[model samples]
Target chain A: MKILQVEGLTKVYGKGDAQVKALDNVSFSVEKGEFIAVVGASGSGKSTLMHLIGGVDRPTTGKVQVDGKDIFTMNESNLAIFRRRNIGLIYQFYNLIPTLTAEENISLPYLLDRRRPNPEKLLEILGLLALTDRRTHLPGQLSGGQQQRVSIGRALINDPAVILADEPTGNLDSRKSRSIMELFKMFNRQYNQTLLIITHDEKIALQADRILTLEDGRILRDEAVRA
Target chain B: MWLSKRALETLSQNIRRIVDGESVDLLDNREGPLSILRNDIQTLVRMKQEQADALRHDKERLKDSLSDISHQLKTPLTSMMVMADLLETAPPEKHAELVRNLQTGLTRTQWLTDALLKMAKLDADAVAFNVRKADAREIVARALEPLNILLEMKGQDVRTAGEAELTCDVRWTAEALGNVIKNASEHSPAGKPILIACGENPIAAWISVTDSGEGLKPGQIARLFRRFQGDGTAGYGIGLPLAQTILRGQNGDIEVDGSGLPPHVAELTDEEYSGATFTLKLYR
Candidate 1:
């Protein structure tokens, strides 16, 4: 299914003199479970494009729809609920709640809803993260590698239709970076999770199922990675 | 009189070198008596200051490490002793009980060591921040890979959308995303779905991880960014804070969105789930 659609999205900042065209007539569509990598120079408006699609910010012009609903049309309150219920976001930083343990961080989405946490399943996640022993530890206590795993757990906790990550491995070492990439590949293949990431590392970018190159607020190239 | 005259000349030359901002080689062996005296004195003073500074920094570091180590060891040691005490008193027929106690103790010790290691690394500046550009989805996938089996076992599925390419630290972000996703997958009900999505706006791009588990309390959300502070039963309190650090370090943020009538698993289609949603907002 076509999970997300963007049409004629244009975002402009400031007025005539100080005006900057961050996104100029950008449009794209994503299927339900495709891995996408967006590669761009420092100021290509690639980040802007991501913000518009995720409803973090509204576009100066154009339409954005997730699962066929126009996100722009939703009110602020509705958008908040919709975003929480529909999207999974990840960052270079783990963003796991520092005060929350690994398990609590993963379960936060559910906790926000006042629902009972599923115990057995949480154990399984801890096992997968090799965090069973570290479950009670704080984020400040875990290694960069382990902390990132907890963040991933938090993202997966919600199981949204789309997974978006920005510079996910920007702070780890090369070995850890490769390990993380391997994990992403494993999830994409095993769970068929649709992933969209923004990065500048060539090695990381080439690992994606699809690559979109951006420069100066435009799509420079789009290609599919060979299996 | 001749010796005094030579000493005065040497002192004046040494002072001139110091004022000129030139490095004076103490061993230059300038036979001039005054130059030799001044060089010797200057070298001795410089060496003494260097030693003093080194000693000071080292002492400070040692003191901090000792305190941190003691603090770190306290909880684990206490837990271990309690568990051990319980096991020692348990009846011989309670084999399962003994085993449980031992396991809990071991787990606590392990947790303490892991925390200490990270703390040490951070303190020593052992963690390197090598930023770069790469695919955000690739990072997410990498983060999610280890959690695949967990999701499948829980009878839950994780999904993603769009091309998620970004410029930042791949290792850091992947770790962050992985932690968040893993948390959601673990807490939410089995057979439920967790969704991950990415898209762009004019100012920045966003990657969101949403789960269909219980939502957060208003009080918890207010202080969610603080360290080691979860009201939930299973929280280690490190995951979200680490994630926040990683994000903030990269000029990004992790925000929680809990609106009226928190969405539930029942409300989510195979398309949506009732869990937490975390957004990683990236700027240009």
Candidate 2:
């Protein structure tokens, strides 16, 4: 099933002559469990595209349909709740709460919704990320890689319909980068989760089932990679 | 009744001793039924002591690890916050530099987080390796392919030789070699040719990447694979360690030869090359 559909997604910053078209009328659809890599040079609107799809930022002129529901059409409060429940976002800097322990951070989404975290799923994710031992450690008390894994754990806690990652491994070394990719691939297969990752590394992009090349705020090429 | 009362008193005394953390000599208590009871209590006490000791040790180790993590995270985080603050207060022209510094700080923190995660997974033996037999040449090609852009940008040349089929996890092995190749290429001088050679022995197959870069100092060689031990200019010092973990997972190993000589330089004249060589080997 098409889990996400972007229609005429246009994101413009500023106005008039000083305006910047971050994403220019880009449209695409992603199937459930599909792994797609978005590649482009810096300032090519790759992040803008991700933000739009993730519903973190509104597009000036476009519609983002996730699970056949137009997320952008919702009010800000509803959109925030929808994003919290349905879109798992990972970033280059991890974006974890420094004061929260790994376990608390992973359970943040559930807490924000005033829902109890599933203990079984929490244990499973902690084991999957190999973070069982660091569960009590705050972000300040964890390594950069560990903190990122916690953020990843947080993203997975909600079991969102789609995951949007922007240069998730850009700050990692090649080994860690590969491991993070492995984790993503594992989740993509195990949970049948949809993934849209923005990356500059060709090797990482090639790991995706499909590659989307962006240039000047437009998808220049969309091609499937041979297994 | 009198004998039973005396036995109960003796047993209660021993239990009290055990509870007080005092050593009870079970062998000294030689009565028939009391002897058995004492022996069981002795075993329980010993087990409890061992468990306590193990728990204490684990707690200490965890404390140390947490301290290290805190140190690693704080450096970048502090820099980022300071830079962000400066950017807020500084002149417009200084904003760019401050923002750049902030970015660098953020990048460092992110790298540290990733490295720690991988380290934890490897330590926990939680990572699953998908091993398969594959062509050694193909793996090298895959590893080197991603690096072609970097090599070309640096005006570097690469030469490969001696292909051999080997049993390995193709994807992971490629990643390991890619890290080695990236390290070599980064340290190598511009326009210098990086040589990759593959060969097989009776028990194992190996590939070596040699680069025309300044060989490691003797001190650096000892701590080369040590996590977070680099000069901070090249990288966060996690790549090589992570590669080592990946290779070891597949019964493979990596060796560094910092003698300032390529392994294949024997075929050419002595003046032809001077650099470092890293060799990766996988058991057959």
Model 1 C-alpha lDDT per residue in residues A1-227, reported as the tens digit of each score: 56688898999999989999999887888875688899898899878988888889999999997755688887776566566556777788878777888788888766765553578877866765668999999899999988888887777665566778888898898667756765665466445567898998866775676788888898888876521
lDDT of 2 at B133: 74
Per-residue lDDT tens digits for candidate 1, residues B1-284, read 14677657766686578557554533222334343354346535444444555577668866866665676568667876776777778788886876877787688668657655654554455777677877767788788887888888998877776555677788778877877787677668888877777765333455777787886543455455544554466555556666766765665666554422112211333464445567775554
DockQ of each: 0.01, 0.01
Interface root-mean-square deviation, candidate 1: 29.8
**Worst window of 10 by summed lDDT in candidate 2 chain B:** B262-271
Candidate 1 DockQ vs. native: 0.01
How much native contact recovery, as a fraction, does model 2 achieve?
Answer: 0.00
The candidate 1 chain B region of ten consecutive residues with least summed lDDT is B259-268
